[model samples]
Target: MPQESSHRVVLMVDENSNPFEMSCAIEVFGLPRPELGRDLYDFRLCAAEPRTRMRDGFFTLSDVADLGAAEEADTLIVPNRPDTDAPRAPHVLDAVRRAHARGARLVGFCSGAFTLAEAGLLHGRPAACHWMWADSFRARFPGVRLDQDVLFVDDGDILTASGSASALDLSLHVVRRDHGAEIANHVSRRLVFAAHRDGGQRQFVERPVPHIRDESLAPVLTWAQERLGEPLTVADLAARARVSQATLHRRFRAQLGTTPLAWLTGERVNLARRFIERGEKRLDVVAARSGLGTAANLRARLRQETGLSPSAYRRRFGPSGGEPVTP
Candidate 1:
């Protein structure tokens, strides 16, 4: 039997829902765990209607709770909805808004972000949704800060995940926040997944997606990543790739769909983030080592990208001591 608690989590499911996402939620919160020696979560599966049919033609009956349940839940989870481009139900949108208004944490996994955006809960908040639907999501919610380069975005009370595997990362992050690293690590071990994955959705973007291969920029990118701390320019990159700067730019635009400077900045930022996470606190040192030149430059760049100050980010992810030595 599950322990009764005032704090509850309501997972909203609907017809044609992706069973894998639903199962991800259940695997994280619904399963019984006596080893933890306490109630982990009060998880409930509720739907808009009483009977919901999955994608594979299986029907599962739900004790369907009304919109009122959203008002009472401490956390509201919107799992992957139908893959179609259809908008979320009006009632479901209202429920999500009401729950958010009542201080409940709202979570969206994969296409579930569409529902949150429709509810107006993601306005001005940084959100991560499936890369494939990023364009549509941005078009629909113009005010929301849609970041396609992260696995998950934990923006205070609201959380959004990129896609399927990212759901696990977000859930593990939640467990870490609520129960600390020890418990979160245990849960991760039980699931046979990494306790934490390095990098973000930037690492998962479809590289070489199109069959038309351009071997031109590939070696240049590999070389650039290897020497992130070294000062690099378009001329240098072009020279290394044995191509004109114009040709290099065209190849980057055609293959990576971004400018050379933008890609280099992204790589530098990624490196700085890794250093910060490893307890490196001296902003000046981090900036120089990551090729951003100065502490002020790093601060401006990091703030523009992640909305976090160097000190704040270091405090959150860096080592226990104040500043880490330059490595």
Candidate 2:
């Protein structure tokens, strides 16, 4: 077990902020948990300005702290903001920059990446944001490498999640980083969520839809998910969907914004990540289970997507074992 910290976490909330995203940070950091023998992070929700109104028809008239709260925090969380296009308030951006300069970690959830970008903190940094607003984000912050596909991106001190639910993933990642996999997994089991989600995964997944108007792809996706351990190819998927290879490729690209092969590789990598996080140290087992066919194939694909080899990936995300592998 690691030594407890006296540092607090300040969550900055603005008017019209998504309550769910705010709640995600609160759930992960605000709640108390003594059973895990871990020191709970003291969480504070502060208004960017004052008298903020939430989107859920509730007014935040009280419990508002000033920018001084951010200065004292060990970690600062910015959940999904109401407006991604608008410039971040100068005061808020200054607080963020000050926190980082003082060695505090800054986290952004979904569209909250815009706040960091506006502060110029994400300049030349690889950040992840919701895929829906990727184009707009790129247009706003030309210097930031906005990766739309990944569920999250961790650039050392600054972390960003791609979508709403990915906020939970990134929070768990922070926990894992500060503590270890055991504590992270314990919290995950308590929350009934996976301990870790690969940051390299695509935001919107590919699946066969019944028609152009058909939005439901759950059944086919579930079916494919069940057979991830098997040798599944695009041709096989197309056959399963009772469509031509060309049609499958076209539909996948239109809906998921990626090729069928790319989608399949992502799914396989996602599976491998789960295994790695679960303390599966053997490369062969991870490769076999993720259907990468061979360990060499897994290493090549994992490095291509994540810029980390299997051993390095496992060490970074795997349970408490040996020392982390050098890149």
Candidate whose TM-score is highest: 2
In candidate 2, where is summed lDDT lowest over 10 consecutive residues? Answer: 318-327
lDDT of 2 by residue, 171-216 (tens): 9888866654456667788898865556665687756456766644
lDDT of 1 by residue, 167-264 (tens): 88888877655543445566777898866542243526334445685555668888998898989887889899888888777777665556788888
Q: In model 1, which regions exceed 4 Å deviation?
A: 1-6, 56-58, 198-327
Runs in model 2 deviating more than 4 A are 1-9, 27-42, 48-51, 55-57, 72-74, 83-89, 124-156, 159-215, 321-327
Q: Which ten residues in a row have the lowest lDDT in candidate 1?
A: 197-206
